[model samples]
Target: MSADTPYREELAHALRVVHAASVLTKSVLRSLKNSVSAETKADDSPVTIADFAAQALIISALHAVYPADAFLGEESADQLRKNEGLAERVWQLVQQAQFSDVQQRENAHARLVFPATKEEMLDVIDRGTNAQLKGRVWVMDPVDGTATFMTGNQYAVCLCLLVDGVQQVTAIGCPNLRVNPQNPVNVKVHEELVDESGFGVILSAIRGEGTSVRTMLSDGLGEPCKIEVRSSTGGKEIKDLDLIESALGSTSLSQAEHKAVAEEVGAKWPGTVIWSQQMKYIALTLGATDVMLRLPLDKARYTHVWDHAGGQLLFQEVGGIIQDIDGGSIDFSHGRRILGDNNYGMIATQPGVFEKVNEAVKAVLARRT
Candidate 1:
């Protein structure tokens, strides 16, 4: 239960669970043959086969180990239950998944026995619909960047363990992210333009335990290495600031407000735009960029807990600070969404420049009013 201790057992279990999910997603991605189709959700977002398979794999693995734990996931089993064709696709991947490969490679402590039938697969996915903020709930986003994933670019499978509404463990698998820091991938690289050599990466953290970076392997995850956030030196000059944003324009802070704030902070104009909320946080964790912001265009747009739960913990554990637009700490105590009614945006940066950027954000947002 303690995040400070090695939590050797918990971290190992989570890595195994997430790594298996990564394998499932990657398999689906490779099968796409350079192009794939998606089904639009009620929210107008895209959902691909990879998303369903990854969520089912992760939840089933965790459920096997912790039967009493609750799950809050992005994709539910309702659609799969009603559509036999879709259920078959997800079930095929689940049945073909080799949990033993991951266990043997990473020496992961958790072992999963795949469900034998489509009914079982649908049941486990449905289990993820639970929206509870009580003790020992796991929040997960099987594919954080569906568009990016479909395009064969960057995407992440995110999972965070929240105990009593507090973030404790974070596990994210970035299958398309590069492991070598020297050859950093462009945050905005298009799918057709992505380099195949980038391979994969896995980032995880426990509250008190430092964040760990590992390369994702075909069989399982690589050995975990500790990672820390680098801070900016000298005074808070706008010129020294760098930005990380969503490449998909609509998902990020208002471009106009972002430009003004970046200009005010002396950050490079426009900043570095990327895909996937989870990947942006990973880039920040790696010291590849400086600031990350998420300002919804509408008042009703809520930040889902599953999206930030893991990314927020990973960033903070690496010396970064994350807060809402009003400069308040992110409250995970609410249900599935983080303060849905409040609808404040999010800002992430190293502690050294957090206040400076916060002030700039405040000024620009004030002018908007």
Candidate 2:
């Protein structure tokens, strides 16, 4: 009998595409500089040229190999069609985009194809608007933190593959994240870290195979190094654990509510607040933070699948755990939104700490109700 190969090709392709997308975004940031502008989406979130261009580039590159796979991404071409100027800007960026590393471009150019025209670029961006939840689907957040990106801080290019609604592969590129975790970059610090040689990381994971990381380079990805969460906090109590949460107030619990949870858990209040959700997952995977919590201000609102899909798998593969407030598995089969009876806020932490953290999260959230 032959052995089963699970998402091997898909994982490789995803890593390559995500690295390319990160390059494209960093280029946009460098070129635009102070001139960067964003259009407000219907949800009132900001969308920039980087977001549109990255989405187009990733979807097109992935589709080149898996033409039959469906895509669900954060950006669509609907706005592009309405505003010709914005559309033109995104198209130009897409055309000029290439792998930052010369060696990577040379190696990937043969297999990955960029959109040939502005029209095709828009179409390629729209192709990711697939709403179906079945079969093989790729979920992407071209630029996970537009606000953070604009500030010249940290952001991520997130990509994941799901088959039958189960996460199979995840690849995320954090362009501004310090390649060396030992000298961790503080999100609160506005000054960007300078590593002229190369200064980013791409983390990837395939189902049951565990997680690995490689430095983002001007030539290609660095050698893969397997990673896992910090060993069980051991004697550390919940209060002693290092925690991370959202820097943005919109998607996370209120300041007072957050404080209560931290106090309840015995951790420091207002524990690290990084703007991007996926980046928080990466932080946990790298053992930068021991716990992450996201208690929605509004329980009825569903979280976009793209926001958490990629990060969830990467963290879990590294011995981390993620569950809704009620401790149920997150349901990704509900198409774009993670909807179900138990769908509530999120709690991601190291393996041994989930139970205690989840209990504290529920206790704090329950008081509000």
Candidate 3:
């Protein structure tokens, strides 16, 4: 680590913790291959052992290092406390969880402390309930795409450091993502899910320091390489740019709106639909697609900060831009959810195309009224 690096310690800790969480989640997913079981949250979203265990593992590791920092995570230990069997299952996963590579385990710099007992696991998981949005706070989504994880597809282990509500550092580990940018992601989903060899990638960014990627190895992360979005659209028209959208089925309303915006912008319809928001951001950073849009189903819907916080920083550091659908900057200061004036949604694009895309989004969405 260089002395001049911004958030050097924080970034390194995030990378290591996210890597451990990825390993834990991958194991849980493999087990699900035999039998799938999950609990439904009040929001109607599914929660699995992977989600709870990963959250516990990450928050505990982070708490060991930065005791003073607050945390806002997507999962709570409430359900675990209510169900003893569920808590035991989660504890088992947390107890056995560790960095898979011998080098990572033995390396003093990368090793992490795990919870010793079930009670400690539940306590660590509850530590993430801190709601204080100010000061040094860590935001995490242990399993950003739990649904995708259940289906044996793409998901991410995400963590971000926020200082006074500003994203300072971000780390996301995609266990099933293909490390090779040249290869198509759709064809090799199953192979990447089942095989750990050269299958994973972790992306991290420090505020103002740009973004970098490393191949996830059993031993540890490979060499870091700087990454940025594609230079320009190569003189392509607005309609010609490739677009990516959410893969979750609940986004049908947004999907329908996306088609209208795509038609209005002259971009292609039925843009690439990936499993998670972070993965969609990854697609943009990797040049897998040119743009991504998330139009709220209605004015009442609010996008969670955890879903976009880390990925947003990664995209911006790589020369991409993100904004609310109405063309304002996406605000993270509102605590858990991104509360804008309206539920127009979000737009992410290559550097030069945000304005054009936002304009089309507004134009198309305006007609819905």
* lDDT by residue (tens digit), candidate 2, 244-279: 766545553556666677788788966666787787
TM-scores, all candidates, are 0.89, 0.90, 0.90
- Candidate 2 has its poorest 10 consecutive residues by lDDT at 182-191
Q: Whole-model lDDT for model 3 versus the true structure?
A: 0.78
Overall lDDT per candidate, in order of appearance: 0.76, 0.78, 0.78
Which lDDT tens digits does candidate 1 get at residues 204-287? 898888788887777666666777444552344657777876654565458777777888777776566667878778777776
**Tens-place lDDT digits, model 3, residues 231-349:** 56556778787788665465744777787878888878756777777777777776667788878766677778899888988888877888776667777777787764543578888
Model 1 error, position 284 (Å)? 0.9
Clashes by residue pair, model 3: 239-266
